[model samples]
Target: MVEVRMRVNGAVRSLEVEPRVSLLDALRDHLGLTGTKKGCNQGACGACTVLVDGERINSCLALAVQYAGREVVTIEGVAADGQAHPLQEAFIRNDGFQCGYCTSGQICSAIGMLAEHRAGVPSAVTEHLAADVELSAAEIRERMSGNLCRCGAYNGIVESIQDVAS
Candidate 1:
């Protein structure tokens, strides 16, 4: 087992996990952060999405040891002092979920996507590479395509993201 230390939700955590252990397992099993769901257990589904160094990643595809010394944020970390994050509130206000299996991952991915847009990162639908890309529905959908909601809440999800983005 390799000892890995990471800052999760503003708290530093240290745990011993096998090198082959996924970050999702390390967080859920070792650290007891179950908000990040394990869906697909592969990189295709974004159910295990989390923020590492403020960037969204599929926790199931990332090795826990690979994130040593990095800042990792799970769904639990998105809120502050029991108050839900604005995006999370937006999700609720817009009915961004149904079965709720993908809500956490969606919220986390949206958070990171917003950050990327804020930093002027362009999506496939972005028109000009030099200018700040305005987040149209197409852009949002394209950027969030990695995550799939089996409950078919795309409309509400897009609306929630648009609400928060605007």
Candidate 2:
């Protein structure tokens, strides 16, 4: 077992875990933060997505030991004060989820996506490389492609993201 210390949801969490354990397992099993779902553990589904240092990453693909000293934010972290994050409220107001299995990951991914866009990051759909990228519907859809909603909630998801982005 190796000792790993990471700030999770604004709290310091230290634990000894197997080097091979994924951050997803550590968070759910060790810390009891089960909001981050474990879907398609191969990292394709994005259901285990979490914010590592404010960037969205598949927790299933990241080793717990590798996250030492980093900040990890699960779905539980987004609304630390009990009042929902804007994205969360937007998701609810927009009905961005159906079965709700992928809701947490979608929300987390959207938060990171918005941050990236605000930081002038361009998606593949960006029309021009040099010009400021517009958060067009296509751009939002392209940027959020990594997160799939099996329940066919894409419309609502995109709408919620757009509402928050605006």
Candidate 3:
């Protein structure tokens, strides 16, 4: 087993894992951060989404060793001072979740999507190539396409993101 150290949430955490151990396993199994769920165990589902250096990625597809010394943020880290992050609040306020299985990934992906929008990253529906990217409903939908909600709470999910984006 190789030793990997990563800044999870806010503190540095060290654990031993095989080179092939997924970041999802390392977080949920090794570190006890179960908020990052394991769904599909493949890249197809965004249920294991998390942030690496402030960018969202599918944790199930990322090896733990590759993230050594990097900053990894899970759903547990999204809030500050024990208060729910604005997105989390918005999620509750907007009924963005159901079944609660995909909520964490949805929230994390939404946060990353917001960051991308603020940086003027364009999505598939973004029409104006030379202009500032607007966070239209279509753009939000396109950008968050990776995360699938089995409960079909997509309308609320989109609304939650829109609430925060605006």
| Tens digit per residue, CA lDDT, model 3, 102-131 | 999999999998887777677788775433
Evaluated at residue 121, the lDDT of candidate 3 is: 74
lDDT of 1 by residue, 42-147 (tens): 8998999999999999999999999999999999999998898999999899999999999999999999999988877888887755434457888899999999
The C-alpha lDDT values of all candidates are: 0.93, 0.92, 0.90
TM-score of 2: 0.95
Candidates 1 and 2 compared: the better one by lDDT is 1
* Location of the lowest summed lDDT over 10 successive residues in candidate 2: 126-135
Mark the regions of model 3 whose C-alpha exceeds 4 Å error after superposition: 129-134
Per-model TM-score on C-alpha atoms: 0.96, 0.95, 0.96
RMSD of each: 1.3, 1.6, 1.5
- Judged by whole-model lDDT over C-alpha atoms, candidate 3 comes out at 0.90
Model 2 regions lying over 4 Å from their true place: 128-134
Determine the backbone clash count of candidate 2: 0
Q: Give the per-residue Cα lDDT of candidate 1 at 71.
A: 99
Number of colliding residue pairs in model 1: 0
Q: Give the TM-score of candidate 3.
A: 0.96
Candidate 3, residue 44: CA error in Å?
Answer: 1.0
Order the numbered candidates by TM-score, best leading.
1, 3, 2
